[model samples]
Target: MCPHFSTGWGNDAMTSTIVFDPLLPWWLIALLALVTACGIALALVRGLSGWPLRALAGAVILAALTGPVYQQEDRKPLTDIVLLLEDESASQRLAERGETTASAAETLAARIEARDNTELRRITVPDGTDNAGTEAMTALSEALAEEPRGRIAGAILLSDGRIHDMDRAPDMPAPLHLLHTGRSDDWDRRLRIDNAPAFAILGEEVSMTLTITDEGAAPEGVRDVPLDISIDGDEPQRFNVPLGREIELPLSLPHGGRNVLQFTTPYVDGELTDRNNTALVQINGVRDRLSVLLVSGEPHAGGRTWRNLLKSDSSVDLVHFTILRPPEKQDGVPVRELSLIAFPTRELFLEKIDDFDLIIFDRYKRRGILPSIYLENVRNYVEKGGAVLIAAGPDFASADSLYRTPIEPIVPARPTARVIEERYRPKVSELGQRHPVTAGLEQEFDGEWGRWMRQIEVEQTAGDMVMTGKDDRPLLVLDRVGEGRIALLASDHAWLWNRGYEGGGPQLELLRRLAHWMMKEPELEEEALWAEATGQRMRIIRRSLSGDIGDVTITSPSGETFERSLEEVSPGRFETQFGGPEIGLYRLENGDQSAVIGLGPAAPVEFEQTIASAAPLAPMLEQSGGGALALEDGMPRIRDVRPGRPAAGRGWIGLTPRGAFETASVTQTALLPAWAVLLLISALVVGGWLREGRR
Candidate 1:
């Protein structure tokens, strides 16, 4: 049984409290106090008994001037909120971390809910795209912003501890504890490309710095790890590298355009994942200088056109030679007066032929200038990875035509001893529209092309005819001999188009593409497959001379394949786009052609440090009077902790008691009523007066 005390008004009790409201000005109160003090002093000096009565009257007047009331509140208790941040980022999905995180979250939620006056705010942090890795802290800050700060007793984070948004972490009011998820024995070996140039000069050595590191509890005395490197999916070259040390590698790109260099390390047992074990770096190859050899049997109208085309390019190093006089023709002019320099046939055709990227035989004919042995060398050069372009003239139909030489085996066409001199419009053939070198040339010229006045009749023996003139004769023929490429233009009147004859054409563009195609430029390859990435989307492209290209198969970073049919955007170009579901390497294949491209960083920041540890969030936890506990050991018990105390222990984590509440209603009552106060003051005055009278 309980006893209660209350005023004798009714069964209901009223609690009395005191509050104040001054009714008089400070100056008036001060004046009253001064007068009372003076009267008291005078009475004491005069030995008068009535001074006490005067003081009592002054006290009653002051008491009536000040208003007093009592205030009461009806408050409802609020539960303490504990923020739980569950990380579902990519790094957290490694090994058995996902399971561990799920388990820990469930246990924590149950424990928090079982406690009295406690609530759990579970917020899930996911992975970020555009190379932005785990942003767990950002999610935590957002959750904190949505809830009342006073009600937030504490925060518990379960993650792999790889957070990218540490700078965005909020200044928490309560303890922030990190329950790191991962095993102690979880280890990983990764290949790191420290420094690489985005563009490297072709045929020149470019230095790349790389480091191989072992994280977590790697085996002791581990050294000389085998590192494999490959360029453009070629066979990998293996090398021994010391672990955890940076090494410099000098590489030379084989050709121009994008070069994919893949660096990988052999997987070791007990490693976390092989995702970071291999890395990809794309370095574009650029030509420092293109060396071109131009051999002209005699000066002609198109000879200067070729010179101008090669000369206009700043990257080309042109070496031009014209055979003015043959050995049979010995004019009576003096040697010094004839010319200052003689053509070095041995240097251009035999000795240093491989030094040039392209060799053009413009209207070349056999006039006893180059020996049979030297011509044989040119043939051997073409068969062994060399490029030759032939611009034919009337001489191509003559007995001295190059078709009569040993190099004719590689020529795509044979000249029929007939030269037609009739105005005829040059048109791209059906195959030309499907060949990368001349695919869109007709469209670029608006389907209108200039006419050539002369064309040497030729019979196509092999190769593809991309352009035709004079009754559908082979005007331009392309062929591949062994590892080399050969292109032949049977007419020299192409220069007429350069002079804007009949509204001109894409003469410059045509010649540029032709030259680059013979040099095996990746962009001009007839059969090629490649991909480009923008954000999380990838544009896959396929180029083929064949009509039936079929579908393209895409393999994701996780080894999942998706097939998509190609859409023909142009003659030879087939393309489609894929919205990447995840970031990493993507492999694209169409029939026999295959290409590998990476959508994000070679080694994403999420997997950069795969061995999970609490070092990243340690500072934040320490600042909030909390500690890090691993889930591998076991789930910790949730406990209530006081403010400014340690919030984590060996087997338990703590949440602060907020003692928060909400006021439902309030009541205000006067401490003393007007009549009651008046009576008390009157009694005090009367008693003082009676005492004075007695005195």
Candidate 2:
């Protein structure tokens, strides 16, 4: 309980505030009053005739103890605060709504300022961050919190009423009214992507969910709508689909990387805006986990190089087998001890060779462990869209070299039977500087690669020789064999770089790039076009081995084409950033190569519901006794209304003016003088004593 208290709660413009200054503590004063009342009740209950007089004298004494005062305030009345919110979000800026909002805000400000004892606060709410759309309710709540609640008479909002955060609307201290900004007949057709996968495997059907909604008094009998669907900016395919129903569209990506899929409808006459008629969806195409077969012939130092590289990648499924002892090796140990299980050469190279994406032959040579027919099947595997990498040791230059076998057809280089045993730094050839696989490698390490101990001499017969070893001999050669690709490394001493013997070069990076190039990763292609986007900004990149790269042609989803030139930042990479891109799919092409990427989500949250809607604000307005009025009808007049009464009528809205004021003066005076109270109390007590004595 508090030690002190005041009785000064009731006050108004007409009535002087009643206050008290008691001589004792308020709790003690209350106790004294309670005891006197109890004593009076007891006398009355006992049928005493003098009880009434005694009670009167006690009341007089108590009244004088409480020092009552008249608090007549020289009130300086405060002006009523009115919050006017202007919604300039993306949805509000559509059509004539923006202009209407501007005009209404000006007129409202003038009318409010013209009124006596009224103040107006205009708040402009912008579009929410990250496409949260119109958050007018959030702004209103903040504005309400900044002002005194009693002083806030009303809140006015000018918008199309397309608020997205009504759930966060605050409890109103006064009426909240929204003056609608758009025409009554405003209608729009929007395409919505309800569900889209962020990533999907290439060459697989992606189930894309969507909807076509006609909002705000759409034309009657429009049961179905015609949509133009395009993938990667290809020629659109027209199809009629049912309206107002969730659609399941099946789409497939042609290549790995980002694929732009666009869905659009014709903009017919009478629609409010055409921006919502189209939508864009970008899905990243992913390559399925690669199956790589690594065959290591006999235990060697560099056998685990390819195995470790392949195993490190989560996307690569590696099947590795190293020959510990050939059949001719006669160690005094059981055959079962020498092998975990019998080698399944037929199962790998013959039966399921097509399942593997890449095959690595590390220091492999024919030892009659398997017939020459098995090696021929390996050649057939390459011709049937498979990749093979040959990391040659001394065995590649021997009599049993793969160049003498059926695999010679795909070998880009033939061994010269001379293993140069001198340390030398390998170098990228002039052609390698332009190829995507090795283009920027020299610049990464400043071309400071560790020296290798030995390299097999090779004569390049076909394809490109991208690297050279001792005395400019071909160290790495790459070529395409029918539907597959092959890479031959003349030296097995790349392990030296991985060992950091002379400050390890980019062995892991080079090998990873090489493996991806062999497996046909889109980013490693020599001739390609692609782009990366951050909002409406994009960096269009063109990679080409040829120096003469032409201008890149950019095609918007709306069918308008623009050309932008490229600047070469590296040997093969050409790129430039383009800004102010509209929200949709974009097609980039440079005659020889082409790519497609979407800049933003197909349907912005603002355009998702283009038609103005007051439904979102209904709960807030209902609780505050406010009503919605369309701008098509006309602006409503502001009126004063008593608190708790309905604040909206036919053509006007009401604001409650709380007569808030500050007290400037107080006059404390006794209701009766202390001498008069004493005299009255003594007479009443004497009379009561005389009456009791006579009875």
Tens digits of lDDT, candidate 1, 295-345: 887788888988998999999999987777654557675533445676577
Give candidate 2's whole-model lDDT: 0.83
Worst 10-residue lDDT window for candidate 2 reads: 1-10
lDDT of 1 at 491: 89
**Model 2, span 160-254: residue lDDT tens:** 88888978889998999988887778788888886788889976899988788888878989998899998778899999999999999888887
Which lDDT value does model 2 have at 383?
A: 83
Off by over 4 Å in 1: 1-69, 324-330, 333-338, 443-450, 534-537, 553-563, 577-589, 667-695
Full-model lDDT for every candidate: 0.85, 0.83
RMSD of each: 5.2, 6.2
TM-score of each: 0.85, 0.80
